[model samples]
Target: MESMLIEKSIQGDVASFEQLIVKYNRYVYNIAFRMMGNEEDAKDMSQEALIKAFKAIGQFKREANFSTWLYRITINVCKDEMRKRKEHVLSYDVENQDEGSMKENIKDESTNPILIYEQLELKETIETALNKLSEDSKAVVVLKDLLGYSYEEIGTILDIPVGTVRSRLNRSRSALKSILQVQLAEQ
Candidate 1:
């Protein structure tokens, strides 16, 4: 099926191209969402990536994974969108931030008012610190620590060397640790 689509798309078959988009829309959107931390930006970046993919279908080489290539485009699109909106207004844009934070997720719900209240402020602080990271670092951090992407796959998707992917992940982890340490010390 993939071979047929590749051949037909290379032959200028728009329907085949559309089929490819349908086949991979979820994947592109997932990558976008993880990188952008929101549904609206994810949807927009995913659509733009699909359009760019269609326009450049002729140049797509089959040796590498097509999904990975599309993932690269979607991530890049998310990064570009983030760059345009460099201000830290995501705190107010709940739709753009991840639904709640780690502390929120771990809040006890079994009628433990004390426990729930204790974690609420900490959760807000952690979420704000995460929002302060650069888009590139955030992408690497989420992909490796949250989504568990290997260095090779991340490098492939980001069009960078594996060493760079590893470096980025290390740097992101260190930055997050420092941010958390400071927050914890203040508490």
Candidate 2:
């Protein structure tokens, strides 16, 4: 079903493309939001990525996973925007995300107020640490840990070898751990 949609989409069928969008929109938007750290920018970047994907559908090779290709486009779009802005301080935009969005998935199931507060604090600290990473490191961490992509899938998306993906993820995790330890100790 997906291959048929991809084929029709490649043939310039808008309806087919829309079907693909329906299936992947949440994933695309979540990545954008995590990268951009804001609702507005995420929306804009996701839209731009989708437009780019539509325009370049013809260039998409059938051997590659369409979602991986789309993820690459989304990451590039966010990275380009971040480069243009010359900023790396990404904050969690949990307050602004609509209900039932990706934010819900990260929400603590506990209704205890203290646990909720602690969770939000930890989330903010993690976001702060993530913001300090280089874009390449951040991308690897996001793809591997946050979005649950396998090493091979991350390698394909980032066009890097699996070893490189593993190394980057390792370094990024170490950095995040150090940052969190320091921040938590200071609190």
Candidate 3:
């Protein structure tokens, strides 16, 4: 179904292109949101990625999964945006943030104030540590750990070697561990 749509879209069928957008828009936006940590930037990046993909549709060879190709485009768009922002912090829109998987592990029957406070503190610390990583390392961490992509897939997405993916992930994890330990000690 997707191949047919891609073929049609590449042939300049506007409806086919719209169908492609409708199908993958949320997927693209979610990836952007994870990398960007905010809805506004996610929306902007996803829109830009889709436009770029559409413009370059003729060049897409269809060897890789469409989703993977789209993901690469999204990552590049986000990285470009990050460069423009020139900030070390993720915007981290609280209003748009989800509880995420971390919440499930920290949840229990009792909603004690102290526990809640500690959990919030832990979340902030981790977010801060993540935001502090270099953009390439942060992207590796997000893609591998948060998004569950294999090292090989991440290599393809980020256009790096699998060895590089493994090394970057290791470095990122080590950095996170160090940062979290220091943060915990400071508390």
Candidate 4:
């Protein structure tokens, strides 16, 4: 079914392409959100990536998975957006905003309240720590850990060697673990 959509979309069928986008929209947005750490930027990047993919459809080879191809486009869009944002250097109130949300989520919980609170807190801590990582590191972490792409699949999506993917993923995980451990200690 996906292969047929890819074939039809590549043949200049606009509706086919639109259908593909609608089908994978959540997946694309999630990748964007994970990479950018914000909803607005993620939406923008996802749209930008889709536009590029539409234009470049002719160049896509059927040998690889369509989702992998889309992943590459999304990652490139995120890299470009990050580059532009680096020039602005705006500081976000990540800590305070997350803490309030964490409290609210934990407060209304009824079952396994302690464990649920700890889990929510940990998720926020990881998100905060992830935001601190460089864009490249964040992409690797998002694709490997959050998205659960296999090592080979991630390597294909990111256009890196499997060994390189493994190394970067290990480094990203190590960095996050260290940062979260420090945050937990401070609490």
lDDT of each: 0.71, 0.79, 0.76, 0.79
Ordering by TM-score: 4, 2, 3, 1
lDDT of 2 by residue, 48-158 (tens): 999999999989998999999999999999999988887444523222323243324334433423243477798888877676666777788888889999999999999
TM-score of each: 0.69, 0.79, 0.75, 0.80
Give the per-residue lDDT digits (tens) of candidate 1, residues 63-100: 98888787777878888888788765443222243434
Error at 38, model 1, angstroms = 2.0
Comparison by TM-score, 2 against 3, better one: 2
Candidate 2 lDDT for residue 176: 65
- Checking candidate 2 for backbone clashes, the offending pairs are none
Q: Which whole-number lDDT from 0 to 100 does residue 134 have in model 4?
A: 71
Candidates 1 and 3 compared by lDDT, better number: 3
Q: Model 3 over residues 1-187: C-alpha lDDT tens digits?
A: 8889999989988789888778678878877877777788889899999989998888887898787788899989988988888665553222233425334433442443334447778777777677666667778888888778899899998999999999878867766655555455456
CA error at residue 40 for candidate 1, angstroms: 1.4
The candidate that achieves the highest lDDT relative to the unseen native structure: 2
**RMSD of every prediction:** 8.0, 9.5, 8.4, 7.7
lDDT of 2 at 152: 99
